[model samples]
Target chain A: MSSPKVEIIESYCKGCSICVEFCPTDVFEMDGFLAKVVRPEACTKCMQCELRCPDFAVKVH
Target chain B: MAFDYEQYLRPGKLPHIWCPGCGHGIVMKGLIRAMDTCGLEKNNTAIVSGIGCASRLPGYVDFNTLHTAHGRAAAFATGIKMAKPEMDVLVVGGDGDGVAIGGNHFIHACRRNIDMTYVLLNNYIYGMTGGQFSPCTPVGAKASTTPYGNPDPTFDIAKLAIGAGATFVARTTAFHATQIDKLIAAGLRHKGMAIIEVLDDCPTAYGRRNKFRSVIDMMKRLKEIAVPIKAAAHMTPEQLEGKVLTGILHQEERPEYCEQYQQVIASAQGD
Candidate 1:
């Protein structure tokens, strides 16, 4: 179990969905227009989502 | 068994700003691993970048970093290395910032054989300020600016660096994370200039236009087309179509710019 969590800065997210697709674990969800981290436990802390997000909205803690 | 990634990542900066499935993440991971392997002191390390999607790396990294003007990372890193010869300097940028807009600076850096390492995160298209075609974008590839198809020829960076006088030149795609890590680490230890071209994917810009199903599919394309030098030597022309060679293309030693500059200064008697 990866204790690390992923948090999204909704204010910065431009609805790019880059992180949602890159995360191998499907840790993110589309909350209508924003990227919502529906499952933090699923995150492996790979930082793939963070690095791939062009808008710089997603982060892995 | 846990990897202490936290030690290098800043807490408040949780999450990065890149788009999903962008290959930038993979390259960043490889760079971090390479720095760790080199046993670099964080204080003594610096990462610089120009204005491009890939140039965003310097900000995410928890090191002495500089995000400079477009296509100027090479020049920026050049000045830094010239001032502090002992610092572990790494310059990160995309094909556009590094080669297109900053083409002259790039060639000169290699020509100077300056003691620095350049990790060019080449995603083919310029993913920043819209998906424009870069100098390194392969011919016939579709980008925002190159609607329908790209008719221009691509820049073979490894060969270009070799011709430009870079002492060390290597090419690796984001798919080869471990290999890229080792190559970058080795490049940092090299005495003169080193350039590592990382073939990354711009899922948003290059990907959608090319009709690729997803980013994974784009990465899989690397395996199908990527050829090691050994394999390439045996392959015929017909078998080489669409394939790009990856690995250390060249390595040699020569008098570096800073070393020669010191000699000239000594000869001038500090005049």
Candidate 2:
């Protein structure tokens, strides 16, 4: 299977840091106020960030 | 595809009015996923809500939506279900709207065993009304209305649903994101009245006064307090103290209200 790609929609991100705090593998980091996928390779596609993000900014594929 | 949330969401309603870390958005995503899992026809599904922060959820979803008065979601949903029994009616509302202002309608609907799903988002405060203590607010919690700390006793929403005669009842927190969809999907598939109580968070209004420094802290609290039913059985009472059980709390087969009403019509017509 191909590695999952994670994307954060900047327009929708409210910088809640829920994605940042909840990612078990530390796949995200805050770039200013928006969540940035800092470690794409570590993403296990657990979907914690995408599911918990209140802003609907995170998407994994 | 990446779950295709945009397909379920209404166009141009992107930035929802909920706060950045409010758990209502998480529940909404879960509801969308549940609807998809159940293969509910968007045109045939009617989502109803009352006035509150959580009530705004119906406006964002692409469905037959109804935004009703404060605490009247269950009543409106009942009318819709009775009028068009084929439509899948779902009610969404907050703790205050569901149990406080519309408490009577909620219990009666449960008693009637209507074939509808009610997702009660218990954020513990009236978030839209500026952090007033709600029926589910924990005792001694500070709210805008209770600056000295709330003295009101809280309602165990899941127990209330079970006691009120809902056929299917479940509970989960927003921190357990995956479980939300699972419980809701189960509720959707159930034949009689299904109530899913989501222990949600209100970071802005509830958290600020309650000493939670940030949204992450509030979410962490939800994560810590929820113990799944299977795991809860293994733990001692001391270990489970202050923790809420998460899973299907009650379920039973019962004659649905609409079908029973149909029987009444048949009997009256001498069929």
Candidate 3:
């Protein structure tokens, strides 16, 4: 299977770090006040980021 | 293909008021997915919520929505369900709203076995009101009001619902993201009163004072503590202490209130 793709919508990201904190695979990193998917290879397609983001900022596929 | 969240959300409601890392969003996503999986019509579904952090959910959903008075979501939902009968009415609220001030309505609605779905978001604190301890707050947990530590015993909302005669009751946490959706869908499918108490995390309000290192830490703790009902059956009481059992806790078929009320109306009109 192909690796999962993770997208972080910068405008919706409030630097809450929920995606970084909740991602079981550590698929995200903080880039200033916004979350950046620095380790997309580790994305497990769990959609934890997409579901848990309060700002509706992340989407995983 | 991806789920088109915009298709189910109200425009200009983006950037919800929930603080960063709060679990209310996760529960909201689970509810929306449940609605999608059930193929519920937006025009036929009514979302009602009371005033609180979790109650803000109805405002974002694209449905017949009501942001009701504090602790009165269920009452409003009951009215909507009775008037429309065929409409799918869902109530969303936090622990404080559902169990504290609204506790009476919650139990009576279950007792009446009304055809409606209630999703109680139990985040342990009153998140929007600055972290006060709620009825579902774990005993001895520190809250803004209980800076020293809480003295009151906490409530088990699922058990309460079951005792109050709800036809369907279940519990799940935000960590079990997919399970949350499945349970919600099941609850919606049930014909009588259905209550799904979701253990959502309020990292800003509940976690910070409780000493969870981060949002992830709280989520991990939720996973660690949730024992599936089937698995819990084999465990000793000692092993099960302080652990929450996840899954359908109880369910039964009963004559729903709205259907029964319709019969009464028909009889009265005939007479």
Against the native complex, each candidate's DockQ, computed on alpha carbons, is 0.14, 0.76, 0.61
> How many residue pairs in model 1 have overlapping backbones?
14
Q: Model 3 segments beyond 4 Å from truth?
A: A1-5, A22-26, A41-46
Ranking by lDDT: 2, 3, 1
Please give, for residues B118-140, the per-residue lDDT of candidate 3 as tens digits: 99999998989889999888989
lDDT, candidate 2, B131-229, per-residue tens = 888988899999988999889888999899889999999999998889999999999999999999999989898998988999999999999999989
Models sorted by DockQ, best on top:
2, 3, 1
**TM-score, second chain, candidate 2:** 0.98
Among all candidates shown, the one with the greatest TM-score: 2
The lDDT for every candidate, in the order shown, is 0.82, 0.93, 0.90
The CA lDDT at B205 in model 1 is 86
Please provide TM-scores computed only on chain A for all of the candidate models, following their numbering.
Answer: 0.88, 0.96, 0.92
RMSD of 3: 1.7
Q: Write the per-residue lDDT of candidate 1 for residues B1-271, one digit (tens) a residue.
A: 2334457765666456677667676688778878888998889988899997888877777889999988888999999988988788899999999888999999999999999999998888889878988888788989888897899998988888899999999888876767888899989999899999998888888898998887668877765777887788999999998788988889999998888888898989965
Which regions of candidate 1 fall more than 4 Å away from where they truly are? A1-61
Better of 1 and 3 by lDDT: 3
Chain A TM-score of prediction number 1? 0.88
Clashing pairs in 3: none
Model 2 in CAPRI terms: which quality? medium
